[model samples]
Target: MEGLSELALDHVAQYFSALSEPSRLRILNYLREGERNVGELAEACECSQANVSRHLSTLAKHGMVVREGRGTAVYYRIADESIYALCDLVCGNVAKRLEAQASLLGSLAPKKKR
Candidate 1:
């Protein structure tokens, strides 16, 4: 936020908003492997081609993924690998919180009769 102007902040908000959808996250995960054409992504995601295209549009808009046009076909790949690291960091914190909650529940359980 230090160097970000108001418009930059708005763009940043849109970027996060794009990543907020599960479908979009799954698309990014698929791209972690390598570039894939829209048809391939659509098949892997078990959704319609239009749906995949829409998700890809959002991902491309946020610069999370990059695409190339080869003749009439287009392929997409992850533009920012750091997004995976961010996801991992958040996942780890969630795991720790869940473990702590489980431990607390175990302590609060009624004791067995002698």
Candidate 2:
């Protein structure tokens, strides 16, 4: 039973490891806006089409995003809105922490000369 639980945790860890990349995180953030074709996503992320496609594939495999084919174009969007909400929550937390750190630093800094 313990071995089975450990194996499940390892799989979950791998999923998070894939998301730890900056490029991938950017791709996910862009998708939160709306469904977009590969070219648009590439432009928004400032990455090559091929690179965006590869990251999208990884995200799709992990069920974080979904790909749809419209005629000849393939578009991607967040697989689950809940995931977007979770990402928003995380972003909010980071912003709050940064704001608090800045306030602390400001308090510790010497006053500027008049």
Give all TM-scores, in the order shown: 0.79, 0.85
Best by lDDT: 1
- Give the 10-residue window scoring lowest on summed lDDT in candidate 2: 1-10
Backbone clash total, candidate 1: 0
How does model 1 fare in lDDT?
A: 0.91
Predicted candidate 2 versus true structure: per-residue lDDT over 1-114, tens digit per residue: 355687788877777777878898898888777899999989998999999999999989888898899999999998878876766787899999999999999999999999
- Give the range where candidate 1 is weakest over 10 consecutive residues by summed lDDT: 83-92
Q: lDDT (0-100) at residue 9 of candidate 2?
A: 86
Off by over 4 Å in 2: 1-4
> Candidate 1: lDDT of 74?
96
Rate residue 9 of model 1 by lDDT.
Answer: 96
